[model samples]
Target: MNHRMIDRNREEGHARLYRDYFSDAPTYTETHFRRRFRMRRSLFLRIEEAVTTHDNYFTQRTDVVGVRGLSSLQKVTAALRMLSYGTAGDAVDDYVRIGESTTIESLKRFVKAIVEVYGDEYLRRTNDEDVSRLLRENEQRGFPEMLGSIDCMHWKWKNCQTGWQDRSHLFEDLAESHGPKVRYTVNGYEYNMGYYLADGIYPSRTTFVKTISKPQGKKRKYFAYAQESVRKDVEEHLEFYNLDLQ
Candidate 1:
């Protein structure tokens, strides 16, 4: 069997990629970069630096045949394009000059590297400092002790296995069973719990501050409108909750 050799001029790919996005005078504007990459260029560069430091696979290397491999920028750009656009791995070959198999490998390694490097800070439980910051921010928005707004995404599990249940960890931290006790005041009435703004579908709980479904008076109507407007913040940010229920 003869080996199929295809010349993918990786150096030109790197040069083109740098000129299009990373050069001192890039072809694309910051707005275009953010729209395509789903993040600011600075944030993407920070992530690139972090992932390169954490994993050697992202570092461009010289092969045994004295050929230079793909740059870290090329590998990461291919991976991010797939992730941000939900496009096929082969779709990046023309732009990033990465083969389909290499693109898939880069995605797997890039995701694993990100989780390993940043999961501790980004995926951990909200700490006291986090709570304080949230409280302050929410208070400025007319919610004195609001931790955050609670919302969920619903996706059909096609071909899901039998006897499996959807278990949510969103309420793990706010569960009355093991949740921390705290005190706050609303309208001069002291309460023993912080609350999250939520919709009517959520079960009534001390931790939930759902809007009124039907308002009878002007004051109640205004209150509902104000609560709903502020609640959109969580939906926009796609924030996470780690509370538990009793």
Candidate 2:
């Protein structure tokens, strides 16, 4: 093998990589950048500032020969694209000017910075004020004393047991087996607590109000219709809130 030829080939490879993947400005408009990164340019700049301040890994550096390396913008853009689309690191190389290994490192540093900077504000448990506000808002929805609704969903567990486990542990702290201890009256019957609307598969505790499978009397039928309607409204409201947050 010719050593000089091998060296020439290697240098040519590096030149092509720099030209094709890391030469100039990203080939995307602001709108496209927002769509791909899931944030506006202004927001991206703010986040870039935070990330760069928190970790020097995101900051741009000069190469050994005084050439400028990748900027913080390119590294963060690569990382955000990977996260927003759940794509592989190399998938963004063509547009973001990032290699797969560097993209992965950017992702790790970005995540760590986010956790360090915003975790305290966003991850805290609900406090007394939150609970009070929830109770007040829920009372206006016609279900007086109601706290919140609970439901279980089945996820595909590739290696776990297929059978569902009871989630009674969630309510273990509550004194009453039926539900919240707030008392309210309905149809001349006094109840000692608010109840969650659940499916029949849930236990027959007072905390859960399941729909009637066989409604014989007019009262039972009316109750079943009303309960299901209220449940639907709550679910729709929650869906809207989630969309707004996104």
Q: Write candidate 2's Cα lDDT for 118-217 as tens digits.
A: 6565434445564566568777776666666554422222111122222223344332364435667887989876667765656567777778998989
Q: Which candidate is the best by TM-score?
A: 1
lDDT of 1 by residue, 1-246 (tens): 697866899989999999998999999998888677766677778889889999999999999999999999999999988876668888979878889999999999998897798777575666788778878878898988777886532312221112122222335544432233457876798887668887776665788888988987999999899889988755543332221110
- Candidate 2 residue-wise lDDT at 105: 92
By summed lDDT, the worst window of 10 consecutive residues in model 1 runs over: 155-164
Query: Which residue segments of model 1 deviate by more than 4 Å?
Result: 1-5, 138-246
Model 2 TM-score on a 0 to 1 scale: 0.47
Q: Evaluate residue 209 in candidate 1 and report its C-alpha lDDT on the 0 to 100 scale.
A: 83
| Model 2 CA RMSD to the hidden true structure, in angstroms | 10.5
